[model samples]
Target: MATRDDGAGAWYHRGQVCCTNRKLDEALACYDKALELSPDNPLLWRRKGFALIKAGRYAEATVCFDRALAIDPDDATAWQRRGYALACMGRKEGAVACFDQALARDPEHILAWQSRGWLLGTLCRYDEAAACYETVLRIDPDRGSAAWHRERMRERRDLAALASEVREAERFMEVPACIREVVRERDYGNAELARAVLREMVGQAERPAVQHR
Candidate 1:
């Protein structure tokens, strides 16, 4: 760690202060000065990236995150910020992948989970999105905003799951009449019945069609 006795540390501290004041440009300048003194410092690069992000220079922020990741591949926050930059650029697939990487590196990252939930919702993965919000609520129940998002997403997920079940039921009706009779007559569980039909259907599909005489 750089100490206050060093010029770079002094500049970095200045950068932090500027960032706290939302003076992003000044913060970037301070970080740039710090980087000039300590070129390989990943924290300086990451902080500069944050300033660039706040300034709406997402492309620059992305590059900064890349540099930070190169310096330390396990930097979860850098991965998360990279995802944020990609998302802001409308590159959702890349953003989601980055967020997944961030989570794989640090599952306890609440902002990463929250952001992933928002991205998953945008991608129409409502159930998965709801799961992410649910995790966020578990991590910080006192956050009313997170609680609200979780409740709404949970409702959507439940509705989606119900609709999925309805569709599966309709599909089940199209199966062999004999299979339906067995299912209706026997006290077999619905899950086992579905598995039985699936096995039969798969076996039939894998076998060659019988030739007509």
Candidate 2:
């Protein structure tokens, strides 16, 4: 494997480091540099879009995700992010459509399932929301929050708030442990899940990749 430590790969990996450190502006710059070297790389666009999402630039993020999908239409991550961007923009229907498309491409996508479930619940579509939660439970029974989602559905919370929460949780999962803890103080999280997420993030960051996690 060609590690990002070598050649043009350096830029991408550095960008990932910046992202992990929550330096989104710097991360975007690094990604842009890498894109200059590898214009066709969908992962670069996806990662850049992720940074844009964190920065609350939903429109720009959606454009980046669109570029990613253009290069690889079946990329479920891009589709999921497109959905997230739409949700951030308060476009509920479009967000749901994008989430549905993501799930279609990757039925096992846990985040997509959760997102769709939460959205459906907010819209008073209890049956569909329950179905989504059921899918999530079937896929990962160990998900402790699965049960709470049903309760959440009953509460009929704001979809926008739910969207923000999901996005924050996801971003938290991507951050380095040191920074994650700091961010966690202000965000809701489970200790075990955070540890698990940190492990995954660390593992991915340490892997040899010309792109990034």
Candidate 3:
């Protein structure tokens, strides 16, 4: 129902009202009309991108975000939304990079931090992911989801460390045949040298024993 007399801003406002009412298709039409009138407007591109996201057209949404960013490279929200669209497409590393761009522009961007942490967590980079959650909690202490994620990452990190320690302990517990040779030397009367080698093997001569109370 928009006429040639309607200005681009008028069409943009109509799109906003349509979006508020959940009429995504109508919103997209209005936005398209607005874009035709003012294709260089970064806000119109970003708004269309958000509407595309709500319509579950993530791939198209990314294109819209790309256009917005091309027009205004410093748009932190556009970068964040591009990352979110990439995430929905299962392109995690790409999504992380976009989120990183957003955070670079606006360090206190909570959504970027949360999304980056989520992607890192899925990648099993628990320590880095935990650090992201810790940053979020520092920025907003009452964020329960970030707190919960931080605890989970901490647990996973501890479990990874414990697993590594267990592997190391298992390796040390494997008795080498060199010990048997040392025992044989002791039996052959080179007892002092054998004891010295045995002490070296156990690291007892170089390391002090723990004092018991």
Best by lDDT: 3
Question: What's model 2's TM-score?
Answer: 0.69
Q: What C-alpha lDDT does candidate 3 achieve relative to the native structure?
A: 0.82
lDDT (Cα, 0-100) at 175 in candidate 1: 52
TM-score of each: 0.70, 0.69, 0.70
Off by over 4 Å in 3: 1-6, 159-213
Q: For residues 113-163, could you state the per-residue lDDT of candidate 1 as single tens digits?
A: 988988887876877888898888788878787777766666555444434
lDDT of each: 0.80, 0.78, 0.82
- Candidate 1 overall lDDT versus native: 0.80
lDDT of 2 by residue, 2-50 (tens): 8433544789899999999999899999999988888788998999999
Query: Which pairs clash (backbone N, Cα, C closer than 3 Å) in model 1?
Result: none
Query: What are the candidates' C-alpha RMSDs?
Result: 9.9, 20.5, 12.6
The residue ranges of model 2 lying beyond 4 angstroms of the native Cα positions read: 1-6, 155-213
Q: Pick the candidate with the highest TM-score.
A: 1
